[model samples]
Target: MSGHLLMGALLTGILAGYGIAIPVGAVGAYLVGLAARERFAVAASAAFGVAVVDGAYALLAVLGGAGLAEPLRPIAVPLGYLSAGALVLLAGLTLLRAVRRYRGPLTVSASSPVRAFLGLLALTAINPATLVYFLALILGRGAEGGGALFVLGALLASASWQLLLVCGGGLLGRALTGARGRLVIAIVSAVLMLVLAVAALTGGSPVG
Candidate 1:
């Protein structure tokens, strides 16, 4: 029975992680595009930023369950709006910077990888979707009774998927080295971010 329970928790955690990470939303797009510009080291940091938050949320869900969700419910709408606005602003800034870089003698400065990680971390943290998803999983997936092993399983799965995304983004960067390719990707990602922002505000399902 103990072994069976462990296997059940493991499978549940894997499902929960994939459920949250599989969606390619504005955040995902920005991650890939940013990596396409900044390369693997920075992108890996950013990916960890996202993964950490997801793990934290999973842990919270397991510990607090619906009790946690209830308190956050009241603020969900306002937080959603705030997150949406932030995403829109980020999109605009990315587009503006891309255009400026393209128009002039552009020098790409090496950004601090720590900053990239923290920036993505904050961005992902603000998205209420993470909490919501974890809450649903905990409530519906029999996670409330599971122990630390369950949370560990969820964290490992989420981190693995996020790292895979980083790898894909790195490959994309290697393949698209030209300025034109970068600019095009930047613009496209910006547009996607805008759409995601609008969706976030309107109570649509989360992509990141």
Candidate 2:
């Protein structure tokens, strides 16, 4: 019975992880862009950071259960707004940097893996989606007998998917290096991110 429960919890966690990670929303857009500019190693660190946060949130959901909603709900809206604002700012900065690169000589600053990890961790943490999603699952009967195993599953699932995105972004970076189309890539990425930001800000799914 214990083994059965553990397996059930692991499966539930995997599903929940994929469910949340599969959505390439504003957060996803930023990660892809980060990977393109920062290389696979740094981006991989960032991806791991995101997965860790997911796992942490999953653990919270299972441990706190329904009680998790109380503290989370009040901050969810604020976090959602803050996240949207940050994305908007990021989109603007991306475009500005792209233009500067186009106009003249641009200096590239190297970012460390640790910095990337912490930056992505903080960025992902601000998104209320991970918390709310896991909380919903808990309330919806998803976390029964779930615990650390569940968090491990969620972390694995999220890590796998996010790393896949990093791979694609790395490939994109390699392809676009010194290519004229790189500018177009920057514009398109920024525009897509901006559009998503607007949608999130105006729509009810800001945190999502």
Candidate 3:
């Protein structure tokens, strides 16, 4: 039973992590575009930042379960809306920056990898809905005895998927060498972010 429980928890965590990461939203889009524009190392750092937030949330879910979620439930909706507004602002800025880059020669000051890491981390961590999502998954899974392993599994799964995204972004960057291609990518990503933001404001789950 112990072995079975461990395996069960691990599988569940993997599913949960993948479920959360698979959706390409504002953050994911920005990540790809940023990777396309920046170095592989920077993109990788940002990818890990995204993964770290997922891992932290997974651990929190395992530890807190419904006990913690109860208090957060009341404010989740408002927080979601607020987060949506923030996303819109972020998207607009990203688009504007992209336009500037397109019009001018793409010149970027060398930035610390830590900036990417921390920026993505803060963006991902602010969503209250993510916590609720993880809470629901953890409660449903009932991995009481294997919480640590469950968290570990979720972290690994999230990390793997996020890294895959970084790789894809790098490849896309390489393929889209022209300024026009980069501009198109920027516009698409910004539009996606705007749509997701609107969805969040209307009580939609903003996971994607």
Please report the TM-score between candidate 1 and the true structure. 0.91
lDDT of 2 at 122: 81
If both were scored by TM-score, which would come out higher, candidate 2 or candidate 3? 3
Q: What is the C-alpha RMSD of each candidate to the true structure, in Å?
A: 1.9, 2.2, 1.9
| TM-scores for every candidate against the unseen true structure | 0.91, 0.88, 0.90
Candidate 1, residue 83: lDDT: 80
Off by over 4 Å in 2: 103-109, 206-208
Per-residue alpha-carbon lDDT of model 1 for 65-101, expressed as tens digits?
Answer: 8888778878888878878888888889888877877
Q: How would you order the candidates by lDDT, starting with the best? A: 3, 1, 2
Lowest lDDT block of 10, candidate 2: 199-208
Across residues 50-167, which tens digit of lDDT does each residue of candidate 3 receive? Answer: 8899989988988888898888978887778777877888788778878888899878635468988997887788787677788999888664578877787888888888888888
Residue 29 alpha-carbon offset, candidate 2, angstroms: 1.5
